[model samples]
Target: MAEKNYYDILGVKKDASDADIKKRYRKLVRQFHPDVSDDPDADNKIAEINNAYETIRDKDKRAEYDAMLDNPFASQGGAGGFGGQSAGGQSGFRWEDMKDQFGDGEAFGGGGFRFDDIFSAFGRGARGSAGAQSSGTSGGFDQFGGGFGAQDSKGQDQHAEISVDLASVYSGDDYSIKLNVPVRKPNGSVDYENKTLKIKIPKGITDGKQIRLAGQGAAGHGGGKNGDLFLKVKITHSDNIRLEGADVYQTLNIAPWEAALGDKVNVTTPTGTLGVSIPKNSKSGSNLRLKGKGIPAKHTGDLYLTLNIVNPEVNTDEAKQAYEQLKQAFADTSIHR
Candidate 1:
């Protein structure tokens, strides 16, 4: 077997740039990955793809390979030709003969051509045996091709975090978040691209909890399905409220009189304003619990309101006089208590 045309095996031209070759190589990998593909020749096809990519992935080696492609007698020593030591005076090089330089399952880079690299473009970096999803990122991009047959193995799952406002979490509405996505460049380097993906946020989602959106993650090659997308919910700080385990905590400020004489005060919450009644003789640090008003969830959360009494300034003579009279009314022991 004479040296197979690396370019032709990858379905590209000899003059094709590394970028062009990589583009074709990935497409072919998707179609022929043994774990996903049932093609009888998938393994052989992928091996060839890996072999071709290995030779060309390296700049110097590709140059030498290119020279040989142009003229079989180009290399120094005309070493055994490419196909192997010509027996019976048979001449010329074949790529398969070069396999001797490296063992099976390894590429020219001292590494194996991994399905991970290919799937990384689709956003999954790790996979379980037989292509089952182990772990990965949210999304990815690459330079390449069309469709493929269904995968024999399932697609890998992807993970990401999206920050959501407290109000949005309270309402459990659909949220759109931006991701600074890492993409594989034509030269096989990494670069970033901003992607805006719309994923449904589950109602009553809590902070630090992950929401799984199926089939919205890393895309699958061939007939394989895209992996699942897991968005970890990160609740942003609210101007007036703090959240904890689905509970909403807020501090309510009331006038001294309101605390002493009991008052119906209107309080504002993320949902809306409500008139809450304060009990007579209510002191600071007192908490008022509103049932089922915290986060909207299956278990339901409660809103806890803590009251703080604010005193009127004694800047005016009349205010000072009023304070004196109020102070005197309460005996020393009562005041101390």
Candidate 2:
């Protein structure tokens, strides 16, 4: 196959900024990743892009490539020629003679250049003396000497979802949670290990919020810092109560007589059951507000009770006869409706 231009593959200019290069790289990688793409040649294209990027992204390699473009044999023969063969393969030159001519110094007065040093820097292989093959094989950026300090004993971070009842968020408390954390051995092998961690749920924590646990993530290599654990909180619905903002709400079923004639009724709250007085002639759907009776927070919210009128189920003959008598008494009264 013909050599491909890295800049063309990435759709970037030769003089593109690092940021632009990275942006283009991410876009192309996402598009051509074999696992995520159905394109028949995606894998081959991705590999080509990788190689192209490796050559152009490096300052030294880019300069060398540019020089080669200017003079195909510049490094091989003319103008301070290094006795090395041009990648074009005209003929091999004496590398030692070029080294002597250039002197054992950093590239152009910068860091002194050593062929072995450059190879090692780029993660090719450990430097060997002249004529010795470097032992390490190249593996993309992972081979770069100063990349990640060590391999992760555990491959990747694990995630989990945690459900909290609405009441718990309203009135914060300590919770004990169990999680399966990936543990790695010294040899960089991983296994799922169950761990119990106690977390404090802050008062007024909202639903769908997240909590981070430091150093509770997957194990790192060579005793490196562990990854972080993220806990996503979901509020569960309750049968007895509904939550709105910071307030608690519930429907109170009351007998028709109790609603019409003022009466004391029992209502349940997070704290405890309390007696509530209903006004006389109260209508169904009338809301009663209890101040500071809702969530336990720094600024407490109120609880609301919506009254619901309920009629007793009459199944006996006597109950039916009494209902008939009541209907007859109110037969002419439009107020009953």
Q: Compare the candidates by TM-score and give the number of the best one.
A: 2
lDDT of 1 by residue, 44-144 (tens): 56645554565566576577656655664333323222222221123432223334444442556767674335445554333321121223111122122
lDDT for every model? 0.61, 0.60
Instruction: Return the lDDT, model 2, position 226.
Output: 75
The candidate that achieves the highest lDDT relative to the unseen native structure: 1
After the best TM-score superposition of candidate 1, give how far the Cα of residue 211 lies from its true spot, in angstroms.
1.9
TM-score of each: 0.51, 0.53
- Residue 270 of model 1, lDDT score: 62
Q: What is the model-wide C-alpha lDDT for candidate 1?
A: 0.61
RMSD of each: 16.0, 11.1
Which residue runs of candidate 2 sit more than 4 Å off their true CA positions?
Answer: 1-158, 165-171, 297-299, 335-337
List runs of model 1 lying over 4 Å from the truth: 1-156, 182-193, 219-225, 335-337
